[model samples]
Target: MPVPSQRYVRNHLLSILSPDDYEAIQSVAEGVALGRRDILIAANKSITHVYFLESGIGSEVAATPEGRRIEVCITGPEGIVGVPLLLDVDRTPHETFVQIEGDAVRVEATAFRRLIEERRLLRGIFAHYAYVAHLQTAGTALSNGSHTLEERLARWLLMCHDRVDGDEFPVTHEFLSTMLGVRRPGVTTAIHSLEGAGMIKARRSHVQVLDRDKLKAAAGDSYGVPETEYRRLLWARR
Candidate 1:
């Protein structure tokens, strides 16, 4: 485990922090490789650390005892994994896990809490970012309640596209089904619909964005609001 250097940073929130703020984080951070399905925060358990992704995507999933779960929030390289900890929470019913394999620099929960306590400005910055994260989750809830399957899928893919380094990403029907809280067959149908409209191209286990505007159109108003808020709240000054 090498120390995470501030020289290389892709997590947008971390990138925006002042030099001293970032240096404080580096003092407590260590680079880690994350694999798909790696649990960062288990439901009902005390959080051990907070992960700031340098690449790939993570998910905060809501689950029921009946064995149903849905991704309520998506954490890309632009976000952090342990958001509830910022609100002084140590545990939550929602589980946070890696949705795609990638790299991250994580800080132990105690050290990070101490850092925030000592640095008021950094805490303010994180609070604004936390609000942006909240907006994304709210957007997911709104889409799940009011959008069609195609619209929802389009929005999800667009979000993924934004996070990935390129237009193409590895995904499967089973994975998409789990994320969207839909059946495998329904995800297939939605993929075909997006392909038919020329917004995306899908093969056996991957999808590529062909036309971003078209995907946005397919998503209608269900997408972009949270993205807008993210930019306004987090990236406006930077």
Candidate 2:
């Protein structure tokens, strides 16, 4: 597969692919436009494709019998949407929905599986991604169970910023309410709390980080490798 210029431009995993492996898988990939609130994977269903985000964000959400849903993780360009495919797990553990409109590279599961079997470098990167995803899942569970809403919000913002590589992005309060599993008013309060603390400035659809260090402290022990792995893997000088 010849590497697409757009793919080689920004994808973390694609950047790490060995020359031949990158070329091998690149041809099978196709780009697609994703809109807000798109359901990429339904809960308990089989995930037949993996999405490599080029410029948007997706959330892994878990829903209960009472219709309560909470976001477990955020995936953007730094990661893929269909996590189970990497581990060869057919059924999805949770629902994946597009949170923002963006572009992504789609690879069918069958083709991706074949690529994984034949490419050692791709296999290793996905393995590391799986471990990091596991760590994120565990950390999110702990954060929800033990942390306050404000703490969780701070942690969520930091994670988003890390993945998007920016402090500001388009995100509405409604989405935050759903992601945090709280009411709109609760999200308002949390934003106000962070603003009052001089940690962030929340506008209509953007929350600017004014004091990242302070926000980091508010997040406490909730931050994990999913937020830091890029630096450790791609930016570190060997």
Candidate 3:
């Protein structure tokens, strides 16, 4: 395969591609815009395509029988949105949605799967990504169970900022409450705490990061280690 443009290679699994492997799959790719709150994949629905986000944030969430939603994981430029394709499954158990409007490169699932079989390096890279996702799930469990609302909110915002490539992104406190598995009031309080500390400036539908170090501190202890490991081990891997 020919080497793809550096831009595509800079996103998620593509970055891990050997030059030759990148060349092989580059031609089939197409880019798409993702709207805010758009459903990328529905729970139990057949996985038709996989997306590599060039911009924006995606949330992987599970809904309970009583209609409660909690974010289990997140995806951005550093990861693909559809994990079921990598796992050789047709449908995902959780729903994936666009958290912030952005664009992505998408390929049909069948093509992706066939391509993976012929590309050893891509397979290894994606396998490592799956492990990272597992780690994220574990981290979320710990954050929800042990961390304070303010800390969890900070961690979530920092993660979003890292993925979206900017300090400001479109997000509502109400939506954040759902992601944090807390009530809207809790989200409001946490937002105020971060804002008071000068870590972020919150508005109607956006929050701009001001002091990233302070935001990281507000995320507390547990969220930091695993997130740091994610950047070091999974994203930094060739």
Task: Go through the candidates in order and give each one's C-alpha lDDT.
Answer: 0.90, 0.81, 0.83
For candidate 1, what is the TM-score?
0.97
Question: What tens-digit string does per-residue lDDT give for candidate 1 at 155-185?
Answer: 9999999999989999999988998999999
Worst 10-residue stretch by lDDT in candidate 2? 1-10
Clashing residue pairs in candidate 3 are 1-23, 1-24, 2-23
RMSD of 2: 2.5
Q: Could you estimate the TM-score for every candidate?
A: 0.97, 0.90, 0.92
Error of 2 at 159 (Å): 0.9
Model 3, 111-159: lDDT tens digits are 8999888887778778777778888888899989998999889888888
Highest lDDT against the true fold, candidate: 1
At residue 212, what lDDT does model 3 achieve? 91
Error of 2 at 127 (Å): 0.8
Give lDDT: candidate 2, residue 54. 77
Candidate 2 C-alpha lDDT tens digits along 1-238: 2225744546666666677776776788877888988988888887878888877788999988888889887888777778787778887758998886777878888999999988877788777777777778888888889999999999999888776766787777898998988899999999999999999988989888888899999998887556576567644521
